[model samples]
Target: MKEFRMAIINLTSSIDRCHNRLDDLDSRLKKIEQRDLEDQPNISGLVATIDHLKSELNVRDQELLANDVEITGISETKEENPHHIVIAVATKLGLTLEDRNIVSVKRVGTTRGYIEGELRPRPRPLVLRLVRRSQRDDLLRAARVRRHLSTVDMGLPGDTTRFYLNERLTYSNRQLFFKTREASARLKWKFSWTRDGKIFVRREHGAASHRIRNEADLQKIFGINEVGAKE
Candidate 1:
């Protein structure tokens, strides 16, 4: 009979110890949850700060390209001189270009191999960095005025292909511009263009131009979400 009572007491003590441990565990869990809740706003603030810094960096990077121009659709050839091509284009535009005014000129990206029974791979873009910002601007303005400048006009042999010249944009701005154009078309916006490495959009004829600096600007001006634009 004594042994039976001792056994019952031991069982009750064990149950009490388990209850205390469970209470301690539950208290620790609640503290951890509270810490996470307190830290959520700080985490969000840090993320915003990081995003702002990145945007500032991109703007600085774009500023460096102020004197650079990008030319696309110009066919490439072996043993071709890019400098001569730039000068020829300038001559066609009625603007005299001296070698001293040109800082650097080269083709960008890798040249792709030719495929049989298919058109030749598109030529990589040519990036020209001029000595002065005004010179770059003048060249681009001339190219815009002569919108139909062709390879043949530059004395290149073969089928006459249209080439385009415009200001060089940073990779981020380029992606944003592409997205803006896509959204503009879908939303039926009238026109979109880039100037001085900044993207602009017009809703209709005689509408105010909206400057789009980032994705948020896109959302604010065009009602576009991160996923895609929506009216």
Candidate 2:
């Protein structure tokens, strides 16, 4: 609970600062535009501040995104609870579970069937869907790459796939190019391309969009819709 509070406080502060800085820059730009042929002073310092603020804002946003993802994942694991999970899903619509609707909560670890001699978890029916495999070799290669510290193809014995900062990995019939940026003297990060040609990353599987060099070269490699999340 304390950690959650801290996260909220940090996120609020970051957003306030980001907005204040951005509003300041926009106001300055508007004044400059409205002025007669006067040469504007070097707003380099202001520009630098905006850049720094944006980076900070991006970090906070990514941290919040990761936190939300974690909370959602943990909430899903609650399906193991012996308590009844009320799934009030609307017809033709998908809904995520939240803490408010959960009830009859009892801690569970092993199979819960033996507890009540007949209590069983509700079954969820899955609708199967088929997707055609890509025929192109390069496209296939682009879609199967994994972004772990290292990867292995179980199909091949004694063969492991290895990747460094600049290695490209494929996933779900799409190519995910892995690249790194120097965050600090001792730290660097791996980023993957988004489906919309954006450079969004999450800390777990993605971090946040650095949007530096990746945006410039993304189109050349994947075109407009190539590297984005699949529809």
Candidate 3:
């Protein structure tokens, strides 16, 4: 009887020890969860800081391109000089752009294949880097005023093609601008444009303009869902 009693006592002690250990483990787990909860705000803040830094970097990159201009829809030719084309366009705009004013000019992107019933391959855009931001701004303003500027106006002999000039934007900004324009058109918004590498959209002629910085802004401002469906 005494031996059985001792055995019972041992079992109770073991169970107590086990309960204590389980209690310790539960306490440790709760503390860990509390720590994680406490850290969540800091984690969120860190993510926001990183995003802000990325946006600042994009702005800096766009600033570097302030003195650059992008000319699109000009047909390319073999052994053609892009510098001469820049000069000719400037002359047509009644702006005298000396050789020193132009830093560099080159065609960017791959030449696209000819479309159906088209004779020549689609030409890539020209990136023209100028000595001053004023010169770039002047060219863009003149081009906008002369909305019908064409290759023939620049004295190009081949098929006359309408060309457009605009400020050079960073690749990311360009994508954002494209998305904003697409969304504006679908939502029946009247005007969408970019200025100084920022995208802006308006509902109509006199509606308030909204600046779109990212896709999330598009969703928030336009009630667009993730897949671009109207909410």
Candidate 4:
């Protein structure tokens, strides 16, 4: 009878220890979960801070490129003078530009390697920067009058080649512009264009256009959540 009583006490003690261990584990798990929940807001705040910095950086880039323009379809030679080309283009556009009006002009990429007995011509785009914003604006306005400009007008060898003139945007802005155009096309928007380093999209025909300054504006217009519209 004494042994039976002792056995009962041992079993009860074992059961109590098991229960205590389970309780301690539960408490530890709850703490871990609480810590994770507490850290979420901090992570979100850091992400928001990063996004704001990117936007500000983009704005600064736009300001820096305010007097820059990009020209495509201009044939390039091994020893091409970009300044002379810029002068020719200005003269073709019927604009008188003083030497001081142009800050610098250069091709944006490397020339293609030459191949023997090959007739194909590869040309790189020209990025031109003017001393004054007004000169850049005047050039853009003149180029806009004609949907496309012919290289022949600039007195280049090939009269058959035509070129396009556009604003010189930063890499990120270029990506954003491309995405905006794709989205607008998919949604059947009436018009889309860029002006003064800003992207604009018109949802309806004859309606006022809205400027899209960042990804958030695109999300609102497209009616998508954060993850879906991840830029």
* Candidate with maximal lDDT: 1
Q: Candidate 4 lDDT, tens digit per residue, 112-163? A: 7656784655678899999988889999999989666777756565435778
Question: 1 or 3: which has the higher TM-score?
Answer: 1
Per-residue lDDT of 49 in model 1:
100
Clashes of each: 0, 14, 0, 0
Candidate 4, residue 164: the lDDT equals 78
TM-score of 1: 0.83
Q: Can you write out model 2's per-residue Cα lDDT over 138-160, one digit (the tens) per residue? A: 22233245234222321222223
Off by over 4 Å in 2: 1-41, 70-231
Which TM-score value belongs to model 3?
0.78
Q: Judged by lDDT relative to the true structure, which candidate is superior, 2 or 3?
A: 3
Worst 10 residues of 3 by lDDT: 222-231
Choose the strongest candidate by TM-score: 1
TM-score order of candidates, top first? 1, 3, 4, 2
Off by over 4 Å in 1: 1-29, 113-118, 157-159, 225-231
Between prediction 3 and prediction 4, the one with superior lDDT is 3
Off by over 4 Å in 4: 1-31, 110-122, 157-159, 225-231
- Model 3: lDDT equals 0.87
lDDT of 1 by residue, 1-231 (tens): 999999999999999999999999999999999999999999999999999999999999999999999988778877779999888878888899999999999999888777688588778898999999999999999988887888775676545788889899999999999999989898889899999999999989998999999988998887745327355
